[model samples]
Target: MKGRVIVLDHIAGREAAALLVDGKLTDLLVDDDSAPRPGAIFRAVCDRPIKGMGGMMLRLPDGETAFLRQGKGLALGQSMLVQVTGYADDGKAVPVTDRVLFKSRYAIVTPGKPGINISRAIRDDDVRDRLLACAHEAGVAEGFGLIIRSSAAEAADEDIIEDIAAMDALATAIMADADGAPEALTEGDGPHVLAWRDWVEPAKVVTDAGGFEDMDVLGQMVSLGQPRVGLDGPAFMYVEPTRALVAVDVNTGGDTSPASTLKANLAACRALPRALRLRGLGGQVVIDMAPMSKAHRREIEGALRSAFKTDTVDTALVGWTPLGHYELQRKRERLPLPAEVMEALA
Candidate 1:
């Protein structure tokens, strides 16, 4: 599978990153430094306890505050480890936990937690059993837990062991070095890096002059320009994301034939998930698909489900509404992609 093309352009003075698969926009990359994300580990100092809320306020080294449950007997100014569980928007405290986890491409490693767990996504009993046996033979140090990722189902035993061992060492290092005021011991995956890992290896990477060094091509097929990319033929889509929901409209453009329209509609379904990821479109999302018969709607839905499986964030199809509009619910943690991008631009 060919990896999607990543375009870094300056949109309204701020850097804009876009992902394109098969010449169609998949997602828009955005970043926010203020919010703590899942899988990020931090060493924080416990401030005062909130008996009413059953938690304690933690001041991070970076000056951000997070709230942790179970404050009883916890003295003030005590240093602790915390990981972001979820965002508590609406002026509420950010939820955090002491249970820290580290994830690689193939496994999730935990410190002070023993035993091995397998991802439920791996449904093959035989494969799961084999992986379990491999984990056992890994001989990982005590006080650590390893959860095999579904991506490891096709991996060799040695590779799995190596990944686990590396993760174990990383976990140990983090604990040993995590000290002092609240600070991050580890950073979450970058948007582009995570996208590449989950999707395809990039066939070509393009950027403007004096762009990010890491994304420039000397060894890779990198191009320098104004960072503009266009889709071939007549397939196109207009994506508008609101505070509460995202609306995507698919168009076949000049294609008028029945077969061509169906083809365009199917392509749009394939592109919709990618657009969602690129834009980080979470919460309720409605795709206004091209008008088609009921029989074709099933095909479009199936295509959408297949494409959605590749999304890094959790999403579900709520089925078609009475108005014949396809409804979807995606998990909301941080602000949507557009909001973050606009903030940066501002």
Candidate 2:
């Protein structure tokens, strides 16, 4: 399946969610609670770039070392555990990465993502409630928030109940099993992945066309109402990340517009910023707009800027050198999406 990647951040506590599909990353949704909390570890008011003081480690509310460095980006009303992705020659904060050690401080919850975070300060009632908590979407009751994942959307309450039961038992059984492991817990596809897959896949794969059908047989489309669907295809892929480097190669193909190579190529140019956004490509992005005309150059430049509006992270076209290449500087956030996202339309 051409799976997408999403990193769920700041849920319940300073925790990050690893949303991977078939392994390629398609999205990164960092969960930051939009609510106000008392004595929150990372207060939202500290809206400044990390000072990267000798790559200091932050002590989390749960007492984990949230790492941080100098020059990390900070959002308004957001908190984080950070460490410098870069360090000075003397081992101080480097203006570079500003890597965050911990996850987002915004441990807020909502619908659309299914999850259950048992507090470290587990209460007997909380444990019992988790143990006896009806996974049934309809009957779920407790002080703790219950995320009903997308996979469970059409699932019978009984099935979810059993899932909850199994999950609780597994958590219970694993406590003894986690004898020496420092990193707490184990996992499977949490509800967020299931919901997202359910939501985005169908609309992307509406193939009523010939034999290349989306035949899960059970591969049914949402007949009534709900969210969208995502397709499971080979076009998607995930790649190992390395220090800031990116290359985009436009392969002439079915959509390459033979009518006018310039226009087709222009589409590709217009696509750079978006392609970058969807895939979260960072570090210097070197773009080759497939060699075109002088006037075409101006048009391509304009298109590149227009597409850049979609970027959540800051970026700039540092102008092309005499080599006819453009430069794009992207932020280094969590795991980036794979470069393969553009090939899906292929």
Task: Say which candidate scores most in lDDT.
Answer: 1
List residue ranges in candidate 1 displaced over 4 A.
1-34, 43-80, 85-99, 111-114, 118-134, 141-143, 150-159, 172-181, 191-235, 255-265, 292-297, 332-346
- Total clashes for model 2: 27
Which residue pairs in candidate 1 have backbone atoms (N, alpha carbon, C) closer than 3 angstroms, thus clashing? 3-200, 26-274, 26-275, 27-278, 27-279, 28-278, 28-279, 61-182
| Candidate 1 per-residue lDDT over residues 10-48, each given as its tens digit | 443444455656654555544555577656778988887
Model 1's TM-score against the true structure: 0.62
Report the lDDT tens digits of candidate 2 across residue range 1-346: 4554333332223332333345433333322222211112231122334444533333333333333443234443344322223112213222222221111111222222345543343345644354334443333223323443434433445665665544444333432342231222322222244234333323232224321122221112111011111212211112122354666544334333443446555566654543454343466777655555656677777877887765545677788769876677766432332223212222
lDDT scores in order: 0.68, 0.38
* Per-prediction TM-score: 0.62, 0.36
Error of 2 at 186 (Å): 22
Alpha-carbon RMSD, candidate 1: 6.8
lDDT of 1 at 129: 97
Cα RMSDs, all models:
6.8, 15.3
